[model samples]
Target: MVTKSSSGEPSSPLSHTDVASGTTGEVVDTTTAPPAQGTAGAEVQQTPLNIAELNAPDGNAPVEINDDDDSFDGDSAIGSDVGSDTTSLTSSVLHYKYENGRTYHAFREGQYIMPNDDKEQDRLDLVHHVWRLILRGELHRAPISKTVQRVLDIGTGTGIWAMEFADEFRSTTVIANDLSPIQPTWVPPNLQFETDDAEDEWLYTQPFDYIHIRNMGASIADWPKLVTRSLENLQPGGWIEIQEHAIEMHSEDGEVPRNTVQWLSEMEGAARTFGKDMNVAKNLGGYLRDAGFEDVHVDKYKIPLGAWARDKRMKEIGRFQQAYRATGLPHII
Candidate 1:
């Protein structure tokens, strides 16, 4: 299993592990995704159902957007500038530096492969909404009791989840980790942000009681290894919930058109070029199993595009998710 290196070259074979992802063996094209979205249901979810409602809440009314590629649905646009002591990104006093008002990390150079700017923030916000919708406004699928303390938020983009969880679980100390210091400085006392790579060897003084990783989408290079790391870093009988999405949009009616499929395929290929797999969400359960996780639960949902969903709740989520994709597309491309 050869993966792309930082320099855009294919590296040596990876360890032979059972990769049980639902990739469909679809051959992806090399062409860049178009600036305009196609009408196919596969890539057809590029228009915002209600951008005015979302963008209007803030001072920015009727947001200006462009059609790019994919988003975190968000990068993990994974770039950098840095703090002098904390982020050890290439020992440049800062792991990341800003280019064109967008932050990119220096350590892995192109490791993140996205821009950390306002557009990305919008995507991140959208991704959070999508997850919250999926989780039914709750945090985790794990049957975690209130007694669980010492939480870890891996790939904690924007630290939204961590801060929320910390506020809810006051007894728990939430440690958020990511490659960039993009988290807010004014965080809850229990919540702290760390600018580091979760894919690297984890060195923590204590094991966490609960771990949450979400919307990391291709940010992590080794999925199974991260599962193992989570298992090791977690306390006995601790819970870890990994919530993400499958890149291959599914439709039971076979309505997704060929052009959209090709566009989505092309997007996946671009991510793979960065050594990350956008389709890894479906295989996370298998990875947890490979890591010897017992009582692992796998839940899959078919989130609809646009307002075509039958259920009211799903329709609302689709509306948000649709707008999110629209806001995110330009940044990913």
Candidate 2:
């Protein structure tokens, strides 16, 4: 039951089937406001669903399982342990009854849920580009792995980057955390995923060398508090990386699309109504600097959607940008 806007782009109608297919990307502006009190959002308004409670009498769980459906090559990198971990995490975080064969844990705040479609594969490819850029010294100018001992990946959806990092640096311990534990468990001995809320008080004993948070604009309610927590968790001289897109407004050469920009602005308004801030990117550097992160570097790049750009690199960026935007609809609006 998906609809389209006046612009004729498809919009995701809220429905059970839409949740299952994960193809619902409807851009609408809702009326919600930011949370008023500090640490109030962390209080569980409703109890989360427990998978163990839904298991059959025969000790079997009723899951709408997809097999041999490796649309994303990174799925192959995740072994059986990771599979079990995904199921376990879903059981802990999700709080919905599956009408028909659809499961809903795949969609949650601060979680990277890829559509079970070809678009997801393209998104994974785009992620690889970011990784390559970082590895080849095209993205981050600082020494990434030289003195990094403990690495923290915030909002690690697929855990691919963390897994790859652990595989690359065998000696470094990588802790990947997300709101929804969708990451695989069978990662390198150095890598592990924890089920915890980022906004909640952290209880980790060890400090990390490098902390990374990507695409978390929609989920995090307080940007300054999040940066403060990161700084508290990081060791002296350690680095924290924050990656996000310009959601409310974006353009090539700063020339934005009127309709697209309007839609994004409406979406941001909706997020504000829902007790979240949609403008995390603009405040990232300021938050970092305020938190005492030295040598802070910020870079912005135009990521086009569709094949609308003439530059070869821009076109490639568009392909990835489309996937990123497609998966991001739920969070924004």
Candidate 3:
């Protein structure tokens, strides 16, 4: 169930009618610190991350990203492969529309609940930036080699991560799929954006060496099936990495405002009525294990809800993140 936050906003990620889910890590500020004027927010700040820092573990020198273009001439269709008779992408051009004071996806209609306008895009970029900082600039934690071939990024919002990955690894083919074709037209030739749904059957000519999923907690209806498909489509010894966090408001000291609790209770009740579980992240590991994934590992990180950190960078990051949660959650709720 979703919990109360100072913002009085929903505490879940995008919604999956079946389950629910966070930020950089696990959390709470318990030093008897007075709660912020509001409940709690899982916001992320805009972080400046570079490809050089990600490639060099020694921090030896910055590796400039090669933004050169390539010519693949392969199938650029995202969902429902083109050559395959049984697979075909919906040829509808999704437009953007405004509703209830927020922007929304007009292409696939309500296939996704989050807005795709500039406001939400900024938040998505900020969320991406914060995670780069939390993960220390690395794109992913998959145990793969430098010699990667085909790579797929599911729900590639804005295609920022995919563009960066393509820029960093010019030799690798990166296919970024999303429900809306909102990515910039100019990008590395190695990277291509396609309009597709991750929940649907994946169609591609070749198998991928690495599959990456992030911040899709509220978008998927059946995560286990997705994982099973990942396992089936991946080449031998391939690895799929999932990054997720919890949404419930937590505190080590257990000091919470009763009013906030009341607020959270009511909000959760509404979510329950809608058939969306706000506690989805708690079961991700179980889903991976149930899908027959070997050596599945889950890492936990506790992120502060606001600018309550003692660390200089974390504190700055926390402030931006707080703004992100405030601005972004409304689009989803």
The digit string of per-residue lDDT tens for model 1 on 23-83 reads 1111111100111222111332222223232121211112111123111121132232321
RMSD of 1: 15.8
Runs in model 1 deviating more than 4 A are 1-101
What is the lDDT, from 0 to 100, of the residue 298 in candidate 3? 54
Q: Model 3, range 203-307, lDDT digits (tens) per residue? A: 886767678877776677677788778766666556677766455544333333444445445655654554444445667667767766655555554554444
Instruction: Highest lDDT: give the candidate number.
Output: 1
Error of 1 at 22 (Å): 25
At residue 114, what lDDT does model 2 achieve?
Answer: 25
Sliding window of 10 residues with minimal summed lDDT for model 2 = 27-36
**Model 1: which ten-residue window has the lowest total lDDT?**
15-24
Instruction: Give the lDDT ranking, best first.
Output: 1, 3, 2
lDDT tens readout by residue for model 2, 136-185: 32333234544468888877766666777788778888898865555665
What TM-score, computed on C-alpha atoms, does each candidate reach?
0.70, 0.64, 0.70
Q: Which is the better candidate, 2 or 3, if ranked by TM-score?
A: 3
Which of the predicted structures, 1 or 2, would earn the higher TM-score when compared with the native?
1
